[model samples]
Target: MELNTSLDVVPVVSIALMGILLFVLGANVTRHRAIRGATGNQMPTDPTDRMFIAQRAHGNAAEYVPTLIVLIVVCALLSDGWWVQALAVVAAASRYVHALGMLTSKTLAAHGPLRDLGAMGTYASGIALGVTAIAAFA
Candidate 1:
């Protein structure tokens, strides 16, 4: 009954975190798309413009989801411990910040580092899972 992270459901921590991000970001994208389609306004004019922040958020969500799933699955498969779980949480949180930064008209999305963070999250997690899986059973 005590909390253990080694081989028993450590992935749940990140699963819950990712789940929250998926739903929240998915809803935001849907809203942005609907607004654009209905109004044809194109929201933000540039990275530093109004409504541009949300658009950037929408973009980040679209970019990182698939790889995140792969990473999560790999970690779950390996029964990854706290580090993997922590990475998953960080990935989710980073994505959220990237998206929210998009909504502020201040260009906190950076058009550079934030995107790189997301890519690293996807690639690192995926690579960790892939390498471990191959090394274990191949």
Candidate 2:
């Protein structure tokens, strides 16, 4: 495990934060749903409020696993060089950006192609890391 360096965990932990955020918020919102909730015949305490939490959990691992794997692979297999570090940073930053973009999607001003841009950033960052890994260590 020549490449099992601490740097590999940074991006992974960052991604884990995103998943945790989504899970905590999403499960909270879901539990609040009145359907088959607490009482079978009574309305929720707040009937007018619907907690709309953004589903940034990637819904499942299949969604975010690709990005996570790319980052981990690059960090572990690629040499500890500037390119690897930069790519990992991009991936980390993009995850936060994407989550931010999603949280603001309901706003009239934020509902547009820009929301997709954050995801694009993540994809582009992963692609860059893959390419760098191939170019530098393959």
Candidate 3:
């Protein structure tokens, strides 16, 4: 099968935005580590700690962002439907919301509305993207 060279702009923009968000979260973690390094706890174990929250926020984004981006890109390449674009936007937005929820929350153990919404959006969009890609073949 021939590849489509004319890629949709929506997925490209979405991917770029998500990449920026991931880097920002990563930098936040690095900043926290640097600021807290003098205390000799480079790897904080407390979920309530700000440093730990930053780490988890970045770590969580790291876990989900790449997979979502891959799915978005695959869907974009396979199909040029507007639904694919919507999925990319939702996936990226959900990740950002999740990171915001993680950073702003007092603790990681408890559920927050933003976190819950973001998780739901992420799961929904991810499944939709997968189905969209598979359906492209049918």
Candidate number achieving the greatest TM-score relative to the actual structure: 3
* Candidate no. 2 TM-score: 0.58
In candidate 2, stretches whose alpha carbon ends up further than 4 angstroms from where it belongs are 1-53, 60-62, 107-114
Listed in order, each prediction's TM-score against the native is 0.60, 0.58, 0.94
Whole-structure CA lDDT of model 2: 0.55
Which pairs clash in the backbone of model 3? none
What is the clash tally of candidate 1? 4
What does candidate 2's lDDT look like per residue over 1-138, in tens digits?
255445556556655665565565556456545444765533323323333323232332236545655555665565666566566656656666665565555542234464576578677877777676666654
Better of 1 and 2 by lDDT: 1
How big is the positional error of residue 70 in model 2, measured in Å on the Cα after superposition? Answer: 4.3
Candidate 1 per-residue C-alpha lDDT over 63-112 given as tens digits, one digit per residue, 9 for 90 to 100? 66556656666655564455666656666666655554455435553555
Question: Candidate 3 residues 22-131, lDDT tens each?
Answer: 99998998898788777768887888989899988888888888999999888888887889989999999999899889999999889899999899999999999989
* RMSD of model 1 against the true structure: 5.4
